[model samples]
Target: MRDTMKPCQHTLSDDVVYKDVVVVGNGPSGMVTSFVLAGNVPYLKDIPEDLPIDEMLRARLSNLPPGQSLYDADLLELAEGLEGRSQNPISLLMDNLLRPCADLGIQADSLIEWRYDVEKEIDHVVLGRGPPGGAWHTFPPQVRTLSPGAWLSLPPHTTDSAERLTASAVAEYCRRYVQACHLQRYFRCNVVVTSVTAAPPGTGAPCSPACPRSASYCVSGYDHKEGRGFRYACRRVVIAAGACDRPNVLPEHISHHALHQLAALEKAAQLNQQHPKSQSRCWWWVRGVSAADAVRLARASGLHVYHLHRTAADSLAKLPLLNYPDYNQVYKMMCDGASGNYTNYKSLPEHMIVEVTPLLSPQTTNTEEENKIRLKKVKLLNLVTNKTVELTVYIVAVLIGSKPDLFFLQTNFDLNTIEIKKCKCNEKKIDEKQCFLRNHWHYLKSVLGQSIQSCKSRYLNYTEINGNIDTKCALPDCNKRDTCTCNTKAERGLAVRECKCEIIPYSNLRREKNCQCQPTNPYSSGLGYGIDPKKPVDGRSNPVAIDKSTHEMFNFPGMYALGPLTADNFIRFIPGGALALVTHIHREMKSE
Candidate 1:
């Protein structure tokens, strides 16, 4: 083995900076994580009646002091003891505290009390492409969040209003959050991370005197503002950069008039102001829920939209109607077709454009102006009818979805070659039967989307297909996909017994091994986290397998995946991922 201490192996950048922890992305997740690491700790304030929390969790908290400060150990213990929704306990706990029983229509006070403790502070730096709001800064000001304003708030600095917040408002709130929490000094905007690799042993000073295990990772990137390359060797690194940076692009080449996001739509609207008001129509090919916002933007800009989607109206059922009113309204417009009050919209279900060709029509003498405006004919393929149709429009916007840019991790290392070991049980295993019995509830909850309150009952929430409950089977004799139907009264008891799918533990999920750990995040793309080096990274691929208790990757020791990368896409739940990460690091430093 090469000596890691001797500076003879590989050249270290001369301007390399060292820190205890380096967080990627200064978005909501990044901001929340930085705030916790900056010494803000949450304590138990007061538990309310019927909060829908795990019974064991309630018992554990009841024993603690009225204003007891929850350290890493306390949090880890509570998370481990939690039942029913333990896939990401820290996130679940945080969501419950921040918005207590929101689904049940119970307006309860927060049970958490936050206090600043300089002793718990960790040395860290947050790096992002833009300011604190991440992708929100890039969205059009008119676009609003699906959830209410309170859902977008960072903990310890929350909002009481229930109205939906605009993109600009959310961005401003994120910037103000950093300043309010005194975390501005740790955030570095306009920096793009290029690579993150294991540092040479004894390459630089450790995070602290005792925690020598950290500061073993080397991060390299480019500083956009400074116009120079930068390097950092930190004890630990957190990937919170989020999934919206890279939009999923179609394979077919099209004209420059194509728009992927609402921001681009806004830009296109400004440039086309010279066009006649009567000739206002845009062609859109959309897939995921994100496209709903784009449709709103197009209509708001006085453009009639011709929306095309691959699937039928059933796919829209995945969105929660109560929380996502805007999405629900969009779904209603699609279902009702292009008539009545929704005359400005046109829905083309089960159809996709196969080809886009620019039409050669009459042009003006001004070359620049003529190039800016043109007509394109799109060939659409109806999947059900096997027919092709063509339509002409000024703009073609394809809004499928997006994923986090995990290219840094992939390009730096071939993850497939890494060896993985089976996770050890916390206590001595007596027998396989007993172990299964003890962990059966957790396994069931993980498969059913991790929350008893959020699980959709078969009788109440199942989509009807041809007048029958959707079994996800085409033929009459075919076996149904593991989904079971249960009445509301028997939901808990029947689901536990009938939902007998494989109970793979979170620690066993390995990207290199290509294990299919279904996405626990409700809004996830339903794509497995495994990374196939040969394939392109979509909006959901390359998610690191993390230990929920600590938010640390199983294969990589000092690395953590936070926010949407961990399946906690919603802002309300990201703070918990942050707490898990900070608490784990704080505990390690204290132990050393």
Candidate 2:
């Protein structure tokens, strides 16, 4: 019955806008994606002398016709055949093409040059919350990027220097890049994407210019500047929206004085203006050794910061002192408390913030300044020592971590949900029911065609990975009916259980139910190793499962993920994901 279902013939509404592509961010990744989709193509130039690029890969590029583009070639065939450390070969190839030998300090000139081709340009729109820079403009004034200014450039526009840049400088640079690349027309600022779902099957009537034969997605959102809602029907949706909008907050209910790390420094500055030269007390809750900008700015704002973090001293000691001088200097200050060059700072390592209580002191005057100093008693628990201490502060800054707000994606659709109609048979006899269901699963697989069989036949071997035995499946999702389990390993005395389900093939529709099972496996969607990209674990090296050649999410055609969501965290490597997406998209458009 599932195989007999026909495609829907619903027509699009007149209010829907049509485009070849819709990019969901305006950050560096989104900017790069837009730059390429806007018709800027990269071609190989004269290979530089004495760079650290791979020899075989360089030979391949050198062999290309001088005017021909590396992008025009089969990037999958070129990149996949070569050996590399990265699981994604195309990402590695693009990175090498953009910045060869960057880590080794050579900073070699880019091997490719971009040229705009009118024929290759596709109709697209960029939706973002702010002007071209995205969230960078919202950072604290004193905040500086972890990457050097030169590393943050979108192609064809380079920064003046390689020095570490301030937040405003980077934000302004990003803004100027849009103008420099002539991409201002394609960007829609102050727009919040509220929902993204598969467009109804037969929405072809209202398509503008021309209708697309490929899969189309519906993107609806609110426009803050226009004070109205907008919708778009696009052939592809690129999720370059980075993972910094929503902060990972503390468990406690936030009080009036508490602020996120990004806004805390600005609030501190405002307090400084209200009470000049006053020694304001602050309690800073941070995780790991990052967040140097907020910590430094908090001290510079005439606030005595009681720094609480979960990082071990040994971790700080392992940092390369020369490369990370700012962080190392912070560690040095931690070592040298209340002494030369570092004052009004205290480091409490291995401590967890237990509770926060707002205290009302005796009011001497009814001034705004008097109310601002209402104390917050922060209770701390030392993880190593199990000792508790309480301290009073004027304000609290929670600077732990952050993730992208992907609620729009979740609300509109379930990424991993698959529809599987329950099999009806007598279930009183357990053994007979198991036999009947197993046979029913085979019947479903047969209906799914040879494509499903080809996928499952390749990876039937049990292999050991990092001391744990699991199925070695190349595809994230497979039709294997095997129950994967491990109990009482001799070496570790640990039990591991990974439930693998027999997935039934059907039309890729959103908001469907999975097979009747206990605790459905997150990996059933074909995402990376069971990692949910929408709400990824903080600091975990979890990349979404994407086609190495195209950067498209597995099982979800016409959808791509870029930037930190793709697990390419550093700005220097993010553009690689953008390049992969554009190459695939451009090829698809050309084929059509």
| Residue range 1-592, candidate 1, lDDT tens digits | 0111222233345677777789988898888888888888888777766567667777877888665566633666666544323247888777777777665555666777888877777778999989888988998887777667766778786556677888899889888888888888999999877666676577455443434333577777778979886878887899887878656566526434466676776777766665675346564657556677777766776777888886534546666777677777878777665352675678887787788777766466745334534677888899888999998887788776666655455222232222222221121223455446535756765543222222222112212211111222111111223332221112211222122233334231221111111111111221123343323333244454688788897667888887777666678888888888887877676656
Q: Which stretches of candidate 1 lie over 4 Å from their true place?
A: 1-14, 48-54, 65-68, 72-77, 80-87, 201-214, 254-257, 277-281, 312-326, 338-342, 360-373, 410-542
Please give the range of 10 consecutive residues that has the lowest summed lDDT in model 2: 486-495
Clash pairs, model 1 backbone: 214-235, 215-234, 215-235, 402-539, 403-539
The 10-residue segment with the lowest total lDDT in model 1:
511-520
Q: Kindly give the number of clashing pairs for every candidate.
A: 5, 0
